[model samples]
Structures are given as C-alpha cells and as structure tokens.
Target: MVSTLSRRTLLGGAVALGATGLLAACGRGGSPTSAQPGSGAWTFTDDTGATVTLDARPTRIAGLNDAIASLWNYGVTPVASFGFTGLADDVNFRGKDLTRVTEVGTTYGEIDIEALVAQQPELIVTHAYPKDSSGTLDPQKPLYGFADLKQQQTVAGIAPIVTIAMSGSAADVVERTVEFAQSIGVSQEALEQPRRDYDAARERLRAATASGLSVMAVAAYPGEGVYIAKAPDDPALLSYTELGLNYPDPGGSDYYWQQVSWENILDHRTDVVLYSLRAMSGADMQQQPTFAQLPAAEAGQVFPWEFSAMDYVAQARTINNLAEHLEGSRKVT
Candidate 1:
C-alpha cells in the first residue's frame, strides 16, 4: 500500500503542477459502434475504422488508456491497464489500486502492442471517435487506427473489439458507458440509481449555489500542475457549470484540462475546490509540505474527485457519488 503524503506536500505538488504545465493526454480511440449482440464476446475495434469481432464478452479486458477509469464503476476491471500501474499512481482518479492491473502504456495514444498482445485480453477497449471525427490523433505516438487494433487481434486470434469515445465530453463518456453495460447485460436497475443520484445531486448543488457558492473543478497532479476542467458552458463542461460553479478564465474549450497555479486558485478564492486523485488517503495530503498552505486546503475547501470518470457513463455514476458526498458537505474519508 502506498502511503499518503502530508497536506503541505500534496498542495506544494499541486502548485508545482500548475507551474510545470501538465495536461492529461487522454482520448477515446474510436467512434461509437452500432449496437449488436455480444455476450461474453471478445470484441474490438481498431483506430482505422475496422472492426474485429470476437467470441465472448471479454472477461480479461485490456484498457489501453488512462481515461478508462469509468470501466471499473461498471465492474469491468481489466487484466491490464496502461499508463499508471493502478489507481494509486493516478493523480486525477482515486479509489483504484491498479497494482493488480497490468501497465500497458504511458500517456494517451501510446500502447505497448507487444505487451497488449501478450495479455491476450478476451476483449480490447479503446477510443475511436477522437481520431475518426477530430483528426486529433496524438502527434507523438503512432496512434492505433481502428483497423490497426483489429489487425492486431486477427494476428493473435484473440477476441473481437469494442470502441468507445474518450474525449467528447463528460456526458459522451457516460452514455457510452451505459451503452456498453447494456450491451453486456448489466442490470438497468444497477445503472439507473447512479443516474438518479446524479440528477438529485445536480439539483441539490444548484439549489445550494443559489445562495452563491463559488465552485471550481480542478485536476491536480504532482509534477504536472493543476488543470481546471473546461467550464460547464460548452457541451463538454456543462455538468459542473449547471452547479453554478465558476471556472477560471479560459472556461472549458481547452480540449485537454487547463493548468492552474496555487496563486491563480487563491486569486479566484473559490469557495469549493473539486480535485481529482487516485487512491489518496487523508494522511497522504497531511504529510505534503505545501498542501496546507493553499487557500482551499487552509480554508477546508478541497474535495477529492477521481479522474477515472473521463469515460462518460461511469462518470455520471461518479458524479452522482460526488454529488451525494458533497451535497451534504460530506468530506471523503
């Protein structure tokens, strides 16, 4: 188990993250597929618009990107997770310890093809829409075209493919997640509660903010710096905006999360700070050198949110969870 850092250290790291200018390189690799039958079928899609059909609903799934954190909420833990080993290492998403999960790649759009093939995942999940519609494939790594991911499966004779979006917006991720769970026969009842909870939470937050509570959603990582979510105005950042929260300048629209410094956070003096963390314990931030100095921390204004919600449907459930917790001003233990 990794130990949590002191609050000062955590806050200092968050400050550093702002100065260093870090943004998560996350995006789904494919477009939404036409729904079809596949129970326990190994399904997959490549980056090139080709589909690879498999025989079973993948049990040993392999997630190629860090944004797949939503998969866990749906109970779709992969045998291997690219990027960070587990949730603990993830600065944005917390409550997951992927130490048991395989590390497939570092950063979005990059994958360990050889290692992926070795895992022999029954199903391979990746992003497709970002590439198909946006033409925003990572410039650095050779992003796998839909066809490429499929071809890889053909060679290994593994399961088929499934493609979902990673970057459209929070809602896009949520809908895709519901669709995926529905595809696999996850109970509608199981899924519905989270949505309802999210709705209730949203309504509650909006009501609470009527009294005027300033809120900002932030993604803070140690060396990477703090990046605020785009404002809720655009289709993407709409969720948080509905809560009557204010985003630092450059509201939404930045595509990748926007970097913010402690000074910037203080300047805004937001009444609430929604932060993302992966497997962070209360003790972790307490030990950090600079965490307590931050206005949010000093004022007891920070709340921990997981970064795994980049996948939409799962995000909705997570949003609901966050709403339930924060609506009552409940702090994460």
Candidate 2:
C-alpha cells in the first residue's frame, strides 16, 4: 500500500489556525498572495470553443485529480479536486503533499457537490478531447478522472470550467496547458526550467532513437488481453514518434489501441517495450509463458510509461526515463 501525506503534515504552519484559516491561506476566500486579482476581468477560451469569463482573476481554483498535480507544478495549486478510485495508492502521487486540497470525489461521474461548493472555487480546470458530430468526445471513450456531460453540468453551475485539450501531440498539449496556466496568473519564470529540461530531454531521446530501435507501447490486462497503443491515437505516443522513436502503426479502424490476445502479443514485435505503469507489474509480465517468447521481453528492454502525464516536469522526466532505457538497447526485431 502506498503511504499518503496527511493534511497536518503538509500544512504545518496553517494547521495551527484551524480549517477555516487554512482554507483562506490556501487561496480559498480571497486573492492569492502570489497572484492578486487585477483590475480587469479574467476570461479564457477552452478547447471546446467555449469561453469562460470571471469577474476577478479566480484565486480559488479546482481541478480534476490528475490535473491538480500538473497545476501545482506550474504554480497554480488547486483548493479542491476530484480523483479516480484508488488515487491514494497511485505511485505518481507518492511523497507529494496534497493534504491542503480537499478531495471532492473518488471516482468519475461521482462528485461531492457539497464539499466542492464548500471550497467555493471560482474556476475549475480539466482536460477536453475532440467531440464528434454527435457531441461526444472522439473515440467516444471516458477520460480517466473526468465526469460525464450531465455531471459536468452540475459542476458548471458552481463555476466556469476551463479545459485544456488532451488531444494532439504531447508537446502541443503541454504548451497549451502552460499557456492556460499563465493566463490564470502562473509566472513564466516558474515554468522556464521545466520547459528547458523537456527540450534538452527531447534532444537526448532523439539521439537515442537514431539507432532505429522500434518501440511498442502496450497495456496488459492480466486476465483479459493486451492493448497495443497506436501513435496517431495517443498524444504521448505521437510525441515519441516526433522525437524519432520508431513505433509501427497497428493498422486498424480503432483510433486508440489495437486489442490482441496474449498468445498473439509477439505479432507486433519490436526492439523495446514501453509498457503502462498503471497495468500489471513487470514481474507479472515476465511470469507469463507467452511474454517470455518476445525478444524485447527476453532482453529486459521494457520501460514503464505513463500516457496521462500533462505537465512539463512529468513530461521531462518521462523523456529522460525513455532515454535511459534506450541507452544500451539494440534493435532485436
């Protein structure tokens, strides 16, 4: 089980003042110390072509659970957030202090309206995907940690929603998100180093991929099957392709992944395997008889990958991790 940071520990100085004072200090009641609401009104256009306007620069902010970490890294910590189930056990949040933020809900489509309203957020941030003609997100899939349209309506009643597009290349998404953060008062200075780090990491990965090593990104569903990620459908995978990593198209009608049985996993052979960190463990994969047959698996070239990373720091870390994995790997397929 993953250990969680407690509220008292994270908000040491403010905890002594009690919940009300702590909430105020955390940018809940009035303007944040770092960013004061300017004389002019604040407005932003979301990816869905919807414009959100505010009377004052929103100091009390709320976000989807996954988005909170990214926002915090960009110097815009949220006062409240809704998370997916088992969020406390997520390794990505380990050692991170989120105790000052109130958790509004634990699963998608389920929100604690009372708790959210209590936080009195003036702005809400989340990710948006391209919508089809029928008014559904592309691929008609549910985004992790995001609520459905009906549930979103409820939240909208409380505050204007600002969304960053989760589609397109990872760099595009990261850039747009940073732009959004800046519009809301996060300083460019705070974002400089992370951007520089990402750029440097990208160059390093590009050099590593020049060796023509093919990488296959996949998620294993222990008892069900394997879902091979396709570059065109995944932002992160597309960014990898742009960085020079060779990922073969899984040619199919599906916009996202190509589902394959465990027995046929080797059909899409490659030199390196970028497996999902959220899925079955590396030990579990190695224990499978079919997994033992793959050259990449046998050579131990599998590296953990997270497709949902939305911030510069996380993306930079991901690039560095991939570069390290490919350091001594050779083409095996």
Candidate 3:
C-alpha cells in the first residue's frame, strides 16, 4: 500500500514484545464453541498454513479497507477498518461508504490502537504473504495496519488476527476470502450470483485480450520516475495474463515492479497503460514532460489499474472496464 508521506506517517507506540512472543501472539489458534447446531467451532488455515480457531463465529470483525470491502460483498461488514493513504479520496472507493465502520489507521501507520481495541473485534482479518525463508512473517508486507512490529504485537494482543495470503492470483485471494466468509456464516447462496458475474466478466476479458493490444501496468513517482509492474509479482496482472492479455514483463527479479526514469518509460512500450489509481492520476501524469512521448499516453490509452480490488463486484467491474479499453485500443507500438 504505497502512499504519500502525509498519509504514511508512523504512529508512536511504547509497548514492545519479543520476536518469539510477537509471533506467538499473532499465531493461529481457535477455541471450541457451540454457537449453532452443526457449527461447533470456526477454524481457518491462512495463506501461510497457519490455523486459527475461534469458539464461535466472529460477529465483530476488523479488517483492512480492502478486506472490509471483500466481506461486504458476502453481506458481512467489518466493525472497524484501516485504510491506505489518501483513503478519503481514493478513486477505487468511490460510491462506497465507510461511515459506520470505525477507522483504526491509515496505510502509512496512524493506528488508533485504543479505538481499535474499543471495537472488541472477535477476529481481525487482513492480507498476508507467506513466511519468509526464515519461517517468520514480515511486517513490511501489506498485511494491514500493523506495518510496525510493535504495532503488530500491540494489536495482536487485542484480538486474534487472521492473515489471508496475498501472494497468489486475485482469483486465489477471492477463493480464500470466500472460504473465510463461509466460516463466518455467510451463505453460499449469497455467493452464487457473484461467482456467475465474475465468470461472465472473465470471459469478456479473455475475448478482449484476443485483440492483442500489448498492455503494461505502472505507477508514477515524484522524481520523474515510473514503476512498471512485474506481472508475476502482481496477482491482478498475473490474472490478466492468465486471461490471455499480452502484458510485457519488465524482466527483473524485483518483487512487484521495475523502477525506471521517465526518460526510459518508452523502453517498455505498449498499446495501453493500466495506471495505478493509488499513485498518480491521469492529470498528474499529463504534467510530466516525457509522459506525452509514450505511445499509450499520446494515444490516450490509459485506464485505472485497481490493484487493491478484493470483492467479486470490484473484480468484475475492473475486468469489464479493461475489456472495454482493450476492445477500443489501437496498436501503437
């Protein structure tokens, strides 16, 4: 979750826990319960293969903004949520309401631990990557409001945290999210229509990709620079490729993107650019002197790349929108 400095300031915390205790506090565990007939206990195996059990289904859930949106699609809303930088103005969240949900913090680390703890969440849900080679979770990964180790330990002590994996494709993330939703008692019937809609949208994307307009996803930086998304590292981009989209790889071992100066932006030419909505806007890019030199920019073949979309509806919308762009694009490079 990238953000400007104003939106990403780290909040101060006094408490600290040892690394072992921190892992233990954040580790998975569930309690037995008799909340409902045939629903003895709630247990979930997260992306890291950690199992968390709860005595009863979680009614009061806390999550990151994207996770909250995912849960909303399943008719389950979080009691509290944390947002990334510029959250109030985030184009991706347009038309969505976050009024009733308590705000814990922003992506740059402004966590209100007292407020979050006041929510009394039975479960805390957020995205997580697999354990590093050292078999430990990395706080640097965008797991939620816990960007800092001290913050993570402080929050972990408030309630059980369920870290869903973000390393797989968007489809994989959605599937795991669905399972988590089901464990919390969201009905399968509620998911049926969304699944169908997603399938339809996916087919549209496939058909559009058949047009062969080379595409690239990128985010602009302050210093006349751009970060071209490395398809393999981005689940959404990977999913697009799986659907037959010809997104060029920037050819680097970087986890998610290849940073390059704007002077070199045209080196990775494409017919279309999926610009990051979380970063710079179209107008912002237009201000860049070299941006107009890019074929995609000159042709006005830019579309919002909503990399944080988690719900079926949002995913479907993104696919359909990209399909429209692909269908209309002309080969420029």
Candidate 4:
C-alpha cells in the first residue's frame, strides 16, 4: 500500500486529541476569544490561537517575508519591509515607498529585535511562528502562533497582531483577511467588495484549471536547498491540477513542501520551473549548479518567482502569475 494520508486528517486527529479539554478551557476563559473593540480596532485569533487586539486600522505597517506582498495585493501599503536585498526593484511593492519604513532586518532564524522595536510600527507581519525545537509556542512576550502575528507584536509593541494565512485558497485568504479587517474596524461595506472580488477570482481560477498547464515551482537556486511548494491536501493544487498541470507529489508527513536536490527533482520531469528569490536576483540563479544543469534550464523553461508566491495563497495568484510568465518564455509547443 502507498499509504496516502491527508494533513487535515492528521491535524484533525490532533485537534481531537485535545479538543475535549481544550473546549473546556475555552469555556472557562482559559482560551483566547475573538472580540470587536472599535470601528477600526478589534481582536482576532492569531494562528497560534492567541487573541490579538488592534487599537485601530494601522496606516504604518512593517512586513517580514511575503506578508508585505499579501498586504500589497490587498492594496494596503506597508511603511517598511524586511529582506530587500536583490529584490528591491521588482516582485510586487517597491522599496522606494519603504524608505521611511526602515529595515527591521532579515526574516527567519534569529529576528532583529532591536531594529524591530525601533520601527514602532502599528502593525508587524511575518510568516512563521516562534517555537523551540519542541514545537511549543514561546511564551515570552506573548508570541502569536503564526509568524506574521508574532513579528507584528515584536515590532508594534501592544498593537493587535494579525496573522493572515496567505498560503491558502483565495477564498480562504480573503475570509481570514476580512476577519482581520473586521477585527480592526473595517466595516462590512468596505469588505464586501474585496470578499466578492476574491471569490470571483477563485471561481475563475477553478474554472480555468481545465486549461491549466503543468507547472513545477521550486527555488531556482538550491544553495539552502530547492523548495517545492506542495501542501499536503492543499486546495491550491486543485487549480493547477485543473489546469492540466501536474504539481509535484509530496512526500509523507510533508505538508508545506519539499527541499530537494536536482537528482530527486528529476523524478517529476516538471515542465515549468517556477523559481523563488529572496535577497537574490533571477540573474543570480545562473550560478547554481542544479539550476544550471536541469533540462528545464537548458530548454529556457525556468521562470523566476517571488518568495511570497511560495506559500499557500499562491493558488489564486500563482496560477495567473504562471500563465503570464509562461506566455513570454519558450515552452514545448
């Protein structure tokens, strides 16, 4: 037996393992509860299940990782961002608007706590959670479960931390974002349009899947290792599968994606290589041995992607992104 499994089933089992007691805790107020504070401020559950309260709609925000990309997609401009080395030119938002934003330093591993505190942003967003090797949430400073929320609190002080899951379906992203906006005082009237538009985009992508193309998304430079963006039970892949393209089959217990080598990647024979760059440029990818040797590279089939597109919400936008990027490149037509 191949022993295929689903992440939802596993997480669901874990949820069930503790649900009875957790539910009791929730009823007794030991658990975090969602609350609306004001017209522009509210409280929502960060990914770590911690309650976060925003004082108001923040005009000054700092983003770590692709959270800025997600915010920009929502039309909210951030004042500053972390990790803008070779990427200051293009990817989505420009660093020119980020001058006043200040560099809070890089993302992942050890965060630049001092610079982040100096920024004094009203909002801070990141993508991963702060956990010890045990995978338990670090209790210090009330770290939010999600990385975006934790980074926000670290920078914004007492500002309500929000962790929007930018790695899910468009509807999932929109729903979470609306919940976030609502918590922060965005009125229903203001959210209705985006909610509708995002849903429309999702539907369009799903419908277009029938005509979808085979896309193999990975980091062009595999120095740290090649990252394959395949989520276990990720609905986003449905769009690609619908588009008639084969996404890389994930390894067991590997929900996020895989970091593989050029040898392992040959198993898929992926047609289109979607590459992600952070602090590096597309031109820099030529220096990578694996990337240089791949047939996809030899055929001029490599497509440069952004760090933001490597996550879950990548479905709705990445589809369109892949289609557009592929249009200009040579394919096996």
lDDT scores in order:
0.47, 0.66, 0.68, 0.45
Put down candidate 4 lDDT per residue, 149-231, tens digits, no spaces.
35544454534344443333433443555455444444566555555554455455555434434566554343445556563
Tens-digit lDDT track of model 2 for 208-320:
98988988877776775677777765667779899888899866665455677789887878888877665676668878788767889999888776644478887888788
Best by lDDT: 3
Q: What is the lDDT for 76 in model 1?
A: 64
Runs in model 4 deviating more than 4 A are: 1-41, 54-65, 72-90, 106-123, 129-160, 165-170, 187-208, 220-227, 233-245, 250-260, 279-299, 309-318, 325-333
Give per-residue CA lDDT, model 1, range 1-333, as digits (tens).
002221112221210010000112334334433335445443334333345554644457776444355566656667766543334555434665656577766543345677777877866555432322232433222222222334434424554445453444456556656666555545667666767765665576556555455555555555454556555322334555656644445443444345555345444445556664542332454344465555556667677655444443444555565555445542221
RMSD of each: 8.8, 10.0, 5.3, 8.4
Candidate 4 shows a clash count of 18
TM-score of 3: 0.84
Which residue pairs show backbone clashes in model 2?
none
Per-residue alpha-carbon lDDT of model 3 for 223-327, expressed as tens digits?
A: 648877776655677788999999887876544557778887768889998777657786788778787778888899988776555667778888888999999
Better of 3 and 4 by TM-score: 3
Structural RMSD, model 2: 10.0
Error of 4 at 279 (Å): 9.1
TM-score of each: 0.58, 0.83, 0.84, 0.60
How good is model 2 by TM-score? Answer: 0.83
- Winner by TM-score between candidate 4 and candidate 1: 4
Candidate 3 global CA lDDT score: 0.68
